[model samples]
Every structure is written in structure tokens, then in C-alpha cells.
Target: MNKLFFSAVIGMTLFLGGCMLAPEYDRPEAPVPSELPSGAAYDGSSSSSEVPLVADLKWREFFPDPKLQQVIATALDNNRDLRLAVLNVERARALYGIQRAELFPAVTATGGGSKQRSSADLTESGYPRTTEQYNANLGVASWEIDFFGRIRSLKEQALQEYLATEEARRSAQIALVAEVARVYLTLAADRENLQLAQSTLETQLGSHDLIRLQYDEGVATELDLRRSQTQVDTASRNIAIYTQQVAQDQNALNLLAGSLVPDELLPVDFASVIPPKELSPGLSSETLLNRPDILAAENRLKGSYAYIGAARAAFFPRISLTAAIGTASDELSGLFSSGSDTWSFAPQIGMPIFDSRTWAAYRVSKATREIALAQYEKTIQTAFREVADALAVRGTVDQQIAAQQSIVDSAQTIYDLSNELFTQGVSGYFGVLDAHRTLYAAQQGLTYLQLARRANQVRLYAVLGGGGNLEVAEADFTN
Candidate 1:
């Protein structure tokens, strides 16, 4: 009984000893710059009206258009890319679990029945025999020890990889939101332009008929009538193209939303769904680190460092302890009897004796760590640039939109005055057409610029690493 107990104790010790191969992991130091470039933001233009980049702003707060907010919300909820991203997170977590478990011992048991026969002929004494053995038992089990920290290093690498996937998910979500915003903005601009084109088409068509009547009375030249007709045709063509663009853009938005056309249809005037105005942009670049892509890079860097440790540990000798305890008896009743008990224990060591290529692996891991560090630094630089671009453009786009709006207003007034003067025979057809063209161009330009400005605001939020951080409100994750 004492021997049996001693065997059990030794088995446990062996099981525990098998887990000593774990390697410690540490983060590699990389010199990160203190601050992003303090250039004159926004493509480096000399503009005094520049606002510092603020990446934080809720999409709802930025556009204030309830309709667009609804669209964005719907997209966020139903997007297939988002669903896939979530699945990826699960996959990474599962891998982390698998790797993390490697540092611990695993135990399993086996039971079997075997029959053996031995035959000898032409020996000192010919012997023929058949034996049947039945085996059944259960005990602790283990494998290679982790004393050198190999498993620990591997586990750390896996954990970092898992974190990387999470960052990737967030990155995908950010991209999805950005695309939705851009498409929605385009929808609004296109719809507005279409309306303008239709209105101009009607006005020009009316003028075309008037010029025909004047030509019939021999008061207007054939040149004037043909030119008026040309203006009406041009407006009509533009409206057709604009109408097509709206349909195509809607389809594009639907694809991003990952919905069938029959499921949900966005309106042509998506500005009705635009987010709010006067949003708050929380101050600073701390929010940039929270961005999923940046976090992903950080995690990858961690993994690279872990891999270096793993590679270094590979250069050391590997030791393992193993043990098994069970019972074997010819009779079923003796299977659990003390007399039938059997056990085996082993300690093993392995070293790479002749593998000349091992040194290359260490070099590879070291190089990979360097690459990860560089990328980490580069990512920071990119983040700063994005924030600065968004910040610099906010005021610039605002000013441009305002200036363009003024131009549209001025052109409209000039067109109205020119049309009046032409009705009184004080202006030529060419003058009226010129004024109409100016108004058309200005209005279209204003619509486009307005959409661009709004889109920039959306981009700003995204660039600032907005969203997902409850503590930092008003950052632009909606880009």
C-alpha cells in the first residue's frame, strides 16, 4: 500500500515537472517620437483660419440631420463586414485560449485489452503459447516541461495576436462608417444638383420657346434661337446624368450596408438624414492611440517581441518529464486489485545538435521585431498627419463653402437682373446665357462644396479615432 501511494506521489511530481519549459516574455523597447509633426497642417498651406484637429465628434452631433444618423445607425447594425469582424475576434480569442493553455499540464487515460501469442520451432525446446492480457487504469499524465519558458513566450505571442484581431475589427468598423458617410454625402450633393439641373432645364426650355417666337417674327437672329435651344439641351443632358448618378450611388450605399435593395432604400436627398451641426471636438492626440489600427500595430509589436524570446529559448536545451500509472490483469476481477498495478516514469532532454540553420531563425525573429518597431513609429506619424489634415481642413472647407455660397447668391442676382434687362431688349441673348451659365456653375459648385465640407467633418471624426471611447466624447470615428 505504501509503494502504491509512493507511486501516485511520484506521478504527480512528474506531471507537475513537465510544465517547466515556459519562457518569460518582455516588451522590446522602441523609441517613439514625443509628438507628431507640427507642420502648418492641411497640406501645409498658410492659413490663419485653421482650427486644430479634433478627432472626436459624434456623427449625430456633426451633421445633426436625423435622417443620415438613422442611415448610419442602420448600417452599423447590419453591415456584413462588421459581422465578419466580430467573428474574427472570436477566432483570435480561441487561438489565445489554445496557446495560453500550453503552459499547463494535460492529463489523459487509456484502457485496452490485448492478446499475445508466441511460437518457437526447432529450438532447444519447442514452445508454443498464447496469452491474453486485459488492461484498465487511470492516473495523472503530462508531457514536455516548460521550465525554459518556451510555452510562456508562445502564449504571450498568441495573446498579442488576439489583441491584433480586435484592433483589426475596430479598424474595419471605422472604415465601414467612413464609407457610409462619404456615400451619404455624395447622395445629398447629387440630389441637390439634380434639383438645380431640373429647375434650370425648365427655365431654359421656356427661354428657347421665346427665342423661337422672336425668330418667327423676324426680330431675333437664327443664331440666337439655335443658342437658346443648345442651352436647354445641355441642361436636359445634365439632369439625365445626375439622375443616373443618384441610382448608382444608392446601390453603392446599399452594398456597404449589406442589404438587399428591397430591404431598405435610402432616399435621393440623404442630407435629410445628415448628422447635426455644432459638434464638440475633444482636444488632443491621446485619442489617436485608441484607434483600432494603431492598437493593432501596437499589439503586433508586442507579438514580435514575444517571438524574439521564443526564438531565443529555442536555442536552449528542452527538458520533459512523463509518467503513467495503470493496472493490467488477466482476470477482470483483478483489474483494480493492488497486485495488478503498474506504472512508468521518464525524464527526457532534447537539444538541437546538428541543425545548422537554427541561428537564422533567431536572426529572423530579431529582424521582425525591428520591423514591428519601425511600423509602430510610422503608424504614429500617420495618425498625427490624419488628425492634422482633418483639423486644418475644417476651417478651410468652412470658409470655402461660405465663399462659394456667396458666389452662388451673387450669380443668382446677376442672372435675375440680366433676364429682366433682356426682356426689356437692353441685353443680348449671349449676355443672358452667360449669366445663366454662371448661376448654374456656382450653384452646382456650392452643392458639391457643401457635401465635401460635411464629408470632411465626418472624416475629421474618424481621423481623430473617434467612437468606442466613452471617456473622450466628440472625436470623429465616423470618417
Candidate 2:
């Protein structure tokens, strides 16, 4: 009889394990264009024909500056936001484990003792009497048998949620790297601007002194001296502004790094900063599908699909089994003696026949899944836009930089000629002041343009989902 019962139990387990009521999942169609937009914005030459995908480049390789790489590594290690993302992935994993455990029985061991006394009038012997009983048992409490796959569906949902959190953590790490690099580049540019301003101020001061001397000798007017001093003052003001900005930029970089950056790791100036070479953005928009944020969105959509499955399973009968096998006797010593053995088997089946809430939940799950689907599509669209914008900037930034450099060169020539002409008494000091101001403005604009060009490369690297080496396991951060 025991063999027959065991065989039946094994057969039931196999049958129920194969049963699933959840609808099959299908990936939604891509909502964006099949090809990336092309025009002047995307006309840049591809990096190298033999080079791998931009995403395959390691962060260290993409950022060749040893100091910049160190800063990025430090930011990844210390950023609070990225740390929180890692912790969330752990939390989701634990939640998934809890849900997955529901498919199995939970057995417990229990023991207890009781003593009772009966009234003399009610006793068969017409005398007061006390009885003692002791019992011990190993039991399984209301473990659900997932015949309709509700437990499986819930487990699937939990699994997808865990995956989504993992992807979110990856996204955070990528953003952190990009942000650190951009801020570091900004600091470099600001330092260069500060130096430029100071140099211009010194030159203007000399010019101011020369004009004052000429005016004293009756060869220059009061206006020429005043205008030269104004140029000096303007340059000094620029120096002050850039100094403040450089300090602020340092503070911002420290905030992202989660600690004060060491001076050794900071760029000395824009000259020391090396911009990354142009990266090929790959041949198609399909690359955006691999982006971490988009992957996270898709996982969320998958989780919603699992939720709908669980809701649909709610309409089916739920079966639970509670069983105990142990011993009961009048005395503690006799609890395990011959003929003291005891066993119980209770199976329950519940179906929601009158409750309207279950149906409502099913509707809610379906609607939620629809919402997730839309959100997934939106994420893809957003990623596509970012890539397109970065490519557009990349295509024109070189030309922009070249043209700006030309303007600076012309302005420098004009300034030199104006200074010589004034010293020769052939032109007024106004020409010298105008040329100097124009040259200064052009130099500042060139500095900003260089920063922009470098920043665009960083953006493209980030939007392309960063390097393959960045795909780290959760254990990497936790340790």
C-alpha cells in the first residue's frame, strides 16, 4: 500500500510540473526607423575598417588618458547611485528566490506536552484524576500544488524583475563613467581658459602702459589709454570667472567620484587632455537594442507578461496538501514506542466561485502588460534619438573646430599688425584694442569648441552602451 501511494505521488508531481496556463510571450515590434538618419550631421568618416564595434572597446581603451581612466574607475567604485543600483539588484534576486521556493514543500518539526484533570463527579472511578500526554511530529503545512502554474508564473515574474534590476545597475555604471569623463574634460578646458585670460591680461597691461606713456608725450589721446585699460580690466574679469568655474568643476567631479579627487589624477590643462579618436557608430540602428536602458525596459515588459499569466492562473482551482507523520502517547517516554505512531493527510481545493476581485485582477494585469509594452517601445525610441544626435554632432564638430582655428589665426595676425602699426605712429590705439579683443574672443571660442568635440565622443561612447569590458557581475561591485 505504501509503494502504491508513493508511486501515485511521484506521478502527480511529474504531471503538475508540466502543466502551465500562462500565455506565450512574444517580443513587440521595433517602433523606430529601420535605418539611422543621414545628412551633413552623419557624414563623418568611419573610424577604422578593422576596428571592432564601439561598444566592444574597453572603457580604458576608449579613454586613453591614464589619469582619466583612473578617475572613471574611482567613480565606478565610489558613486552612491551606482552602489544603490547594485544593492537593488541583490534585493530583486532575493525576492525572486522567495517566490521560486513556493513551488516546494516546507516541512517543520514540532513537539509538545499537555496535562489535564477531570472532575471527580465526571470520572468513571468517581475520584479526581490527572492525565499526561506527550506528542512529537514532523509535518508539512498547506503547501500549494501548482497544477495551473500560478507559482511558476510568479516565479517567472520575479526572475524578470531581477534581470531588469541587473540591467539598471549596468546602465548606472555606464552613466557614471561618462559623467566623470565629461566633468574631467570640462575642468581641463576651464584651466586652459583661465591661463588664456591671464596671459591676455598681461599683454593688455603692457599695451595700456605703452599708451599712457605715448599720451604723456602728446602722441596718444586720453581715449586710447582708457580703451587699453578697459581691455586689461575685461581680461582680468575673465580670469576671475574662469577661476571660479574651474573650482566648481572640481567640486562637481568630486561629488560624482564620491570622494575628493587626487591632484595627480586631475588633468593639468587642456593641452594634457587627449580626445578619443573618432569611433564608428556601426552600420545600423539595430545596435540600440543592446543598450542597457532598453534591455531593462524589455525585461520589465517580460515581467508584466508573467504577471498576466499569474492573474489568469487565479481563475483555476488551487490545491494544497498538509500532511504529518509522527507519534502520540500518554507519556513522554512512550511517544516513540510500539503502536504509538501517528500520521495525517489533508488535501484542500479552493476555487473562486463568487469573488469578483479575481476577475478584476486579471483585467488589471492585462492592462499593466499593455503599459509595459508601450514603455519598452518608448525606451527604444529614446535610445535611437540619443545615438542620432551624437552622430550628428560628431559629423560636424571637426569642420567646426577647423573653421574656428582659422578664425583665431586670422585674429592673431590682425592683432600683431595693429600693435606694430600703433608703435610706428601709423594707426590709432583703437585698431590695436579692437584686434586684441577679437583675438581673445576667438581663442576662448576655440577652447569651448574643443571641449564640445571631446564631449561628443564621450556621449557617443555612452549611447553606444559603453565597452564590453564594462559588463561586470554583481559580485564585482559587492566585493
Model 2 lDDT tens row, 54-118: 77687888899989888888888889999999999999989988998898899999999999999
Over 222-298, each residue of candidate 1 has an lDDT whose tens digit, in order, gives 99998999998999899999999988888888888777434234555634544434333444455567777777898
lDDT for model 2: 0.87
Task: Tell me how many residue pairs clash in candidate 2.
Answer: 0
Scanning candidate 1 in windows of ten residues, the lowest lDDT window is: 470-479
Candidate 1 residue 290 Cα shift, in angstroms, is 1.9
TM-score (C-alpha, index-matched) for candidate 2: 0.95
TM per prediction: 0.84, 0.95
The lDDT leader among the candidates is 2
Which candidate should be chosen as best, given TM-score against the real structure? 2
